[model samples]
Target: MKRTKKERQQLLQETISENPFITDEELAEKFQVSIQTIRLDRLELSIPELRERIKNVAAKQFEENVKSLSLEEVVGEIIDIETDRYAISIFDVKEEHVFARNAIARGHHLFAQANSLAVAVIDAEVVLTAKASIQYVRPVRLGERVVAKAKVNEISAARTIVEVISSVGNETVFMGTFNMHRSM
Candidate 1:
């Protein structure tokens, strides 16, 4: 018996859903297909590679389990911290961070850096983004290390307003105000 590409893809998706950690080579062997074929099937189904799928699942789990600001890989680290304000760190925009073109850092990465820093400054176990108004003052070029600083501007029982500034060296690149809410 032979299966169509769609059938094979369905089987592959089922196999992946049952055991997401299964290797491509293992899946290929089980499906009697080449590794490249398995990869193509995954791509056709809009499924990420095994590692990426794992990371996605992990990110989802983290989001569900904690209310803290979750920075994606594109945003790097925490460089400095003040009592009510903190600075987040990021490396230059790279191929991985760009979508439409290689020149601009995707907006989500900028948001993540600022939001993460805002959450980091809050004295709470978990924080969630309620709203944000960001202004792209300047485009962040590739290879430019930037810093995002967030300050707690105001606090209420339900929300905290944070002011975030992102700068590359001495040049201000972006700025925003974020509303964060605590889960508990």
Candidate 2:
């Protein structure tokens, strides 16, 4: 079934609203239209590109929500953050993140993405990772998008335990338990 121009535009707005991280290519594929058409629809609707949208959301959320660190200190694009509760970020493995020979992403990048999210989820003025136990479940290839989700498992007066899991789709690529010191 074909949708009218107005109908398509309305649905496009709804789709983008539902998932701001969606790419133009994904939208085009879902709507059964050219990428150019999605671009045009987004432009006419005054929606920014994925990069700008991520930056805008991260900046706003970091400034208003995160107390442990600045925006630049956090790794990846932080899509959601609730201090002392939970936080989520998306890391795209690029050429710099992967080894040239194997095209597999280095472990440190995944660790950094998860570690930073753990810190960002803390509500204290100063938060530091005192200890971490991590496991690399699978090798993430270049161009894979890593979604790191952090949750505060327990919080003491001077310490917090954060559990972070980084995944590509439904498969876990990395998982870590970070013990953080929160200075009051």
- TM-scores of the candidates are 0.56, 0.77
| Leading candidate by TM-score | 2
Candidate 1, poorest ten consecutive residues by summed lDDT? 65-74
- Clashing residue pairs in candidate 1 are none
* Candidate 2 global TM-score: 0.77
lDDT of 1 by residue, 1-184 (tens): 7788888999999999988778999999998989999988988888888767665664554455323554352255654454344544555567777666556777888877787777766766767788889999988876777778777888788788899988998999899999988755
Q: Alpha-carbon error at 42 in model 1, in Å?
A: 49
The candidate that achieves the highest lDDT relative to the unseen native structure: 2
The positional error of residue 40 in candidate 1, measured at the CA in angstroms, is 52
In angstroms, the error of model 1 at 126 is 2.2
- Give Cα-based local distance difference scores for all models: 0.74, 0.92
RMSD of each: 11.1, 4.1
Clashing pairs in 2: none
- Which ranges in model 1 have alpha carbons more than 4 Å from their true place? 1-74, 100-102
Residue-wise C-alpha lDDT for candidate 2, range 42-81, written one tens digit per residue: 9999999998887787678789988888888888989888
